[model samples]
Target: MNTGAVLLYHAAQLYCNLYKVTDFQAKETAGIGVYSALSLINHSCYPSVKHYFIGRSLVMRAVRPISAGEELTISYIKPFQKAKKQERKILLQRYWFSCTCEACVNDWPTFPNLPALRFKCLGCKNPLDGRPRVCYACVTKRRDPDKPQTEQMEVVDSIWRGILNACCTDLALNIGQKKTREDYLTVCQNLQLLYEHVAMPCQHVIIMHQLLYKYFEDEF
Candidate 1:
């Protein structure tokens, strides 16, 4: 190849190496290919569409309804995997474009708080009442000295129970050959919420992460 042709070929190869996403299964790399036109799509932490393989062809499916004139977007990164500011800056630097996506602009709360959200308070050993600031005993007790420490637990417990029941129902329905990718994703999403909100360490949290891991292994 001529010098110019060699340079262009190397540039294309580098682009593919850096930007192409892998489609995998069972912890093995299934295949890799470029979606040249789909690469034109912008990114959002909350994307309107999802792109995956249907056999050997790439297909884009709307995860939700879309309206005309809306700019098409796909996520270049996972949700909550990085803090908003850091992710945005990294995207801008890597892609040479600033993200004006709704999630970035609105400063949505990422799952960066999962560790705090998933465990009990260091002090008092009770549930961290809300937002992982401190346990009810450590903070609320000063204000409502007459109120029982378990008072807030009632509301949190009710919410956890409701989520647990819904997840169980969904799991039961999905037990057979009737389950779809969407259903599996839905279950994992709920379990993620349960894990984030349930401040007590429970076996269910481990199960939730396991189910999520299985879904990702099989599908992503």
Candidate 2:
């Protein structure tokens, strides 16, 4: 019946930018927020940056190196928690948009779907997944004389072991041993290294972003 209310309703449908306000310390949902600037950010299944609330204000931080001219993004959904096909469906059904992120386009398996360890290419270190032998990039690189051979994949065994034993690796959160901030930092660092070798949306990378955010929060 109210003219202004009708307009606001339509605008909310088209422009409403909602984000889960989380209290990391409490590990619970604080509420939700809608900021005009943050609203402008587009959704990516694999976001380049992450944002958090600081006393009702928002702080955005980059989790990985960003090249010049690259667009900043954040994930509205937990891409690591769900499978690719289901994640795509959720994004389409809820946001009315399909994700074309590297993970989605390449059909990278989510963290839930990955095994304790994954196989990587002997050349590029890119995840082989189910691909036969080496990936196409490595195959092409073989022809180039300038490109050097990647290290043996077996070298990352320690790194993988670190992740498997990480406090955040399992649901229990390391009940046996107390995890100090330094401990978390070590795990996050190893995760970043693991990320460099695996495919995009790899468990190590996504989980690293999540943990690194919490680590920095504790640091500063």
Distance from true position, residue 144, model 2, in Å?
A: 14
- List TM-scores for all candidates, in order: 0.48, 0.65
Runs in model 2 deviating more than 4 A are 1-10, 13-15, 115-189, 216-219
Worst 10 residues of 1 by lDDT: 140-149
Q: Which candidate is the best by lDDT?
A: 2
Which candidate has the top score in TM-score?
2
lDDT for 151 in candidate 1 is 48
True-vs-predicted CA distance for residue 220, candidate 1, Å = 17
What Cα-based lDDT does every candidate model obtain? 0.54, 0.64
Which pairs clash (backbone N, Cα, C closer than 3 Å) in model 2?
Answer: none
**Which residues of candidate 1, in runs, are more than 4 Å off?**
1-27, 80-82, 112-170, 173-176, 180-220
Q: What lDDT score goes with residue 200 in model 2? A: 54
